[model samples]
Target chain A: MSEAESSTAAQAVAPVQVHYCEVCTFPLEYCEFGSSFKKCKESLQKEDPELYDKYYSDEALQAKLGTLSLEAQAKLEKEAAKKEAKAEAKADAALKKKLASQVTIKRIERNKRKHVTSVHGLEAFGVDLKKAAKQFAQKFATGASVTKNLQGQEEIIVQGDVSGEIVELIEEGVGVLKGIPIDNVVEVEDKPKKKGGD
Target chain B: MFKKFSPSTDISGQTSVKSSVQRSLRTNILSQWKVDPETFDQIWPKKEPITLVKCREHISIYQLHGEPLFFQHYDGPLFPTLRLVHKYPFILPKVGVDRGAIRFLLAGAHMMCPGLTSKGGYLPPADSGLPAGAAVAIFAEGKEHAVGLGVLKLSTEDIKKVNKDIGVETVHYLGDDLWAIQKL
Candidate 1:
């Protein structure tokens, strides 16, 4: 038998196990569980087969919650849509939070002809400072290392005015694409870049 | 007597390599440098197009869409990132020269054996020394910064054997056309 077919059978003495909605298999909070029903599908359909059948044949779930075939379909659709929208917003906020975690890229003037570029705060986003520093130094073709800033936080220090390059590297997702977890979202408001592409 | 230094003029200009060559060059160079391939590829991805413009018998200037990226010196394969040693110090073996020799070196003079053997001069440990014909970062004494790239005609042992003068026959010194040619 297929996996779904096999899941239809119910067992006694069931452990307090989590069950999913049969139709969608959505393990959402709205889904309920118990014995003689392996999943919410069995419970909901067994209790109301006509409702389930009509709901599947419904065109849209949101138009009517009445006795129309689309009534339950509408509710399920609304539930799924609300959940999807909430999840989307939450993900967007989380990404914004991660990006806004102060990925400060600074070009400190050390002396005449010797500038130091420091990329700080990326470690909060799960970037390995040493690895990121090596990539930066290699990209700009300069020397760089993972050193402690005045705040004792780990930062990447490179030996040049790589402020421009550092920003581009981040914006272009150089470190992020390499599993840095900066979300790889492009910042639309980047200052006019001088280096076309390096 | 110090043999007068003569640099081979650049020829065989502006040659493009296929994607295969670029991939191989990237692999070969990073391997020779003992760098992790994953990290190097992540940094300098395969998508970037590189052009090899021959600058000398042993060296070529690598360009990315006509913008020079680096100068590469070849022994068996490309050592493209040698020019970036100021940022990555351990890329090559380093030898320090007296402060007095800095001016001559930057003026594109061939580093004499005496310049390296004289007071204030330094040579890398013979055992751990860079093999002859390998790339070296020539740093000046006290300043402790690389002045240029050079290839040794004689190994550290050979330099000691010839003891009175010339340790390395300079390949590309500071202020040379290659150094000033590309702003990489």
Candidate 2:
């Protein structure tokens, strides 16, 4: 019985095209339950007013109140509003923290004349450390890998002293390095102290 | 099952499935799901090899070009990802909960019998009632698209008769960590 149904469905039906809300990524019909329903509604109203009306207009709201009582509907609205505010505050805090975070590129002296550049704190800006290391390796033709630093945080270690070039690339917003603010990128030099002299 | 998944920390490894394994998997999926050959092909092209992303625990996610299509826990039934279910809703049998349960469902709660047996809810007739342990697309009252996916803990008739406790154990839902991942 199932086989026959599947064969007919295979011949007759096509996949449904679901339209998702850009703000919350939920289907437009389910946006009311999303944390950013107000933003989703606003964006939908702008992008597709017809759809917005179909889902959000007075007639639609009346029809949607099917078995749910008025008291329950009012409570749901209040809860949704509270959730939206909380989510908005959380997003604001995250953005502020990201903006305040710094990316440190350090040049460490390995020998008398050799140096290795280690970039720290790029992950805070949402950069993929492995992909960034690969990009650096390909761009400079040198070995680059993501490794844990002494602080137990992940950092990209490039085999050459290309800290200056890396800074320039970050400032230029090349590839995955985009969206990192130049003001937060600081370059530091670390040299071993000479024991006998002092 | 995918309520708290993080790819970087949770995924153990990813490997491309061999042709023989892929063939068996294809047959398993065809038998398990209600999808047809053409629709299945549209979701997962025949030529493209699927990558098996093994996560912590025994969960295995099958991905086509970084987009997760379906997943399974241990040897349980193969459940399509919520995103895939949204695109091809008919792939699974549907059960709907009432509007009052929508908020709790979004919070990753299991579907209680009361929510399913309510006036706003819907269930298949006794003649076509689904058996226990069946994968189902969970829809909400007055909503056009599915909001989650689950496995029926009890048969549809039993759920109507019992009218209490959890009816469907939620495997994936809207706003879950899995749904947040568009690509991996």
Candidate 3:
């Protein structure tokens, strides 16, 4: 009885290590319900054939249908396939939109000699605006902040006119500025409006 | 509670927990869970401070090194994240649902009583029945890892007797938005 108690205690202390699928981030057994079931299955088959066989073998599939009827299983599979297609299409559309979006860097004239560079639309490429502002501040030793534009859209405004350097850094993919295409980056000059009745 | 969470908009702020609050929280977790001291220590070390992420509602998440370990609703019982439950499967009493309910559970629906009383499902026997409002790790039929975490809305015996309605209120599930945000 003491030996059995010790074994149980040991078991209680140890944590179980679970294997997760890379494609869907679910456990290996739950990949069937994930949207990327086919990709998960293929990846698992390539990584660990034995484990894949245990989950996907003919006998294993038969055993999994113990309580659920064949018709229910068929319906579930159909639903899973539909979900996969929908998710795939959604991801493709998002990617296309991101690629099509343009990043605008405007050099606004604060005075005759001073200007502030405002970068817009970097968030569309998955970059954190606050972090990018901090990076710009540190890289150029100037004050950079995220503020709303006339359209109420957030943009990073740097203290000095560093539009050329900003474009070069973005092209080089510095820090959090990765994945932004150089071709999509456009430079614009916003001259201060002439004072009325000057 | 985390079915439709998005970190960017939903989260309000994050602050490190005070030592006094951390002590009470540690004790609360020790009493509430079946985890051993050594295992708990490994999960949350003595020197490391936990971050409390306050969301839009009364929900607050406890994160360790950017990985969310647990969350709470108001002053309710702390529920472990599904990822944490997957690693330490024995922390909560386990209740499984049948194969047919797996898809619905993944879609963030509450677990019905029939799913628990079905042939493929399992509940603790009468001698060790759980009371209502107890946290449970939800497993799926023929699956080893937990698919969700929930709180029992009905006692184990009452569930078996009635065998209808929502038995478990799912707090977090496998493919919910909470599971998608691996790091904060």
**TM-score, chain A, per candidate?**
0.43, 0.93, 0.91
For each candidate, give the interface RMSD after superposing the true interface residues on Cα.
34.4, 3.3, 4.0
Measured with C-alpha atoms, the lDDT of residue A61 in candidate 2 is: 88
Model 3 lDDT, residue B57, Cα: 82
Question: Which rank order by TM-score, best down to worst?
Answer: 2, 3, 1
What stretches of model 2 exceed 4 Å from their correct place? A1-12
Q: For residues B1-184, what per-residue lDDT tens digits would candidate 2 score against the true structure?
A: 8789999999999999999999999999999998777778888878899999999999999999999989999999999999888777778888999999999999999999999999988888899999999999999999988999999999999999999999999999999999999999
Residue B75 accuracy (lDDT) in model 2: 95
lDDT of each: 0.57, 0.92, 0.91
Q: Write the per-residue lDDT of candidate 1 for residues A154-190, one digit (tens) a residue.
A: 8778888877767667766775424343443222222
Q: Residue A194 lDDT in model 3?
A: 95
Residue A22 lDDT in model 3? 90
Model 2: CAPRI class: medium
**Highest DockQ against the true fold, candidate:** 2
Worst ten in a row by lDDT for model 3 chain B: B34-43
Off by over 4 Å in 1: A1-198, B1-13, B55-59, B72-83
